[model samples]
Target chain A: MKLEKLDPTVKACTSLVCVILLSFQYLVSLNIAVFVLSLLLLLTCTRARGIQVLKLLLPALVAAFGLFVTGYFHGRGTRAEDLQKIAAMPYAVRAAMSTGLYPALQISTRLLAYAGFGLLFALSTDGEAFIFSLMHRCRLSPKFAYGILAAIRLMPNMVREFKSVRLAFRARGMQLRWYSLPPVFTMLVNSIRWSQCVAMAMESKGFDGDAPRTCSIVPKLRWYDLAFFSCWITGILVGMCLLRY
Target chain B: MKWKLKDILMIAVCAVLFGVIFLGATYAGGALYGLLLPLGMPSLGYEPFYGLYFMAVAFAVYVIRKPGVGIVAEILAAVIETLMGNFFGPIIILSGFVQGAGFELIFALTKYKRFDFKTMALAAVICSCVTLGYNLIVSGYDMIALPVLALMLAVRIVSAVVIDAIVTPRLADGLARAGVLGGYAVCEGVAKDLDC
Candidate 1:
């Protein structure tokens, strides 16, 4: 396989992408409608489901609820039956609850939006485009850009193992004790072993050979890519107008 | 030192992995449900937070053993994430710089002599600590009372050690074992035919 799909023709696609990314500056902060649409565009483009988005969203919910719930009890200065105490400062607890809750949610929601866009980029767009975009267009060193591409290819498995660790520990009748240290250790050992096997396999294939790299699956930008960017950016601009009223 | 094609491939791969990690971290830390926990300790899904970033850098250093490898990998990854319009944007890039420094400092401390497993672990821990300290300041985790700050730091540091030293390293090892990373003997790959 070609390491990157760079033939002179792919340049047309890249220029179109440049235009689309330019539009994002406008749509990213417009309003809830534009933002939601952008979110939807990202979601549909990536082909991820609503549930997937929700999974990505779960963290924001947890942080907000956790801090708010804790802060509420902590505010009353009455320790509930099962709640942890938030230091016995007079308004400190309340301040933490009051001041911290919104920020936590805000910060987290913003995180979700970012992740949405990120997941969109990863799921929808070809990884090669982004990698080459950095190297060929953004002036990033090829070494660095390709490294990221390699890692992205390897990432799903990392997520799988991360999930596997959580599952395997649960299956083994392990209880959550002190950050699940024991299970983590077990997972660590296994993962180390996995890395070794994979590394050897790669080398055996002469991947370690001192051959120059070449692009295998280069992406070409299409009208859709351009249209998508325009929609996102213009949506952002329109939202900004609405927010003003 | 001249740049090699192999070096570029490795750096690019690790950089993207960096993005995947942060995406996982933020979701976990900020998630409302599926909160993985110990009896009393909160799992800082963010534990691996910025730590993965530095690992990518360190991995570059470990694999290439070349100057600027760590920083370059990190900066490029941050650029990808930023261009995708990450919420934190370039701020993440800034963190990458400090964390990269943290990784570089470890190699410098070792005088670039040995790239042992334990030494790499030490670097991960130290760099993570640097990130934690900086995160506290930037995110205002430092504004909390002394005890809370201390607790958070302790939790973060320990988690960083475990995740960096054990989980991530081993995962790289496992992939190597599965015959994925066949290029370098930098701990991201298997040490086959060794005197074990």
Candidate 2:
């Protein structure tokens, strides 16, 4: 990205990048620790930081509350302290349960982290530059990468169209009943047409039939990206290595 | 009336939408599962509802009412899925073939005569089996009991019906309304087909 608009895009791209990177942490406790740190990073960084953080906490809270309620009513409120009481059951199941929660937590964190990053990218990074990065650094063919990226950018509009079409039907006095399917079906067909129309328009404009193209903007990985990435890895490694107790 | 420019665009768009759904689900599902296996989950898995991918062929054939189009749509979807970084890597290509065929069989039974509710359900059912068979053969899920298989089958059937019967029909109708499905007799007359 040009120096003018780099900060936000890199941040946004990283969330997805980080999640993709997150798959590497499948071995042990490091995964959980990394996920927690990522959640923290996303909270501080995203524009709607307070609300975003709250959104993150909501699910975990829900899960924990559900777990607590289940244990309270069903398991007599099993707690960490009661580990000794249920000591008769085999260790593997217990171990697995504890580990299971960690992954779930991390999974949500990774997902939200990507969303935040997406926000950062959408808000800051120039879309063209970002696509260029994948083309240049990642070696993705410029043609395919840009074509798909352009298509993906249409996703929000597609979803919105879906909503409006429903509204349009309702405005026309059609009720959206379970058995009623025509109007909704028509909308689906229309969506398909829109894409093809766009594809054709692009084709007419020489977009789909090209071998490859070049971009004026090239993403240079700056000191900030390196710094943030290093800190991210170091936190996870330290957390994993030191928390062995 | 003949196939208009809008009709061609619409049908192509529907085809792409189908591709997107399949690719998106597979890519996201596989990535999520892959990530979960390491950081937190080593034991369980999600509800396995993307199992609907297995029935793509049947869904395509039923709605599109063309022989090769169903197969092409599924394969294209799988390719998109891979490009999106589906967790299973290249194997997704192979899965697309058998799963697409599973749904295709139901249509073949009616000899491609109709896209009626019964045929649609049959397509979904056969597809569910195809996916289950795939999971049993290639996927490493341990066979627990008759009950587990039964449960999985039930979930799969419900999902397929919802997808094929409800979602697919609505889409077919929309295209038909927009004059997109003019060439396909089965998908035609949506205003009369559901008798809306």
lDDT score, residue B162, model 2? Answer: 78
Cα lDDT tens digits for candidate 1, B41-61: 232334535455565676566
Q: What's the true lDDT of residue A155 in model 1?
A: 55
- What are the TM-scores, per candidate, against the unseen true structure? 0.51, 0.50
Q: What local distance difference test score does each model get?
A: 0.50, 0.50
| Sliding window of 10 residues with minimal summed lDDT for model 2 chain A | A68-77
Candidate 2's DockQ is: 0.13
For B98-136, candidate 2 gives per-residue lDDT tens digits of 777777776666777778788787777887787777654
Identify the CAPRI category of the predicted complex in candidate 1: incorrect
Candidate that would win on TM-score: 1
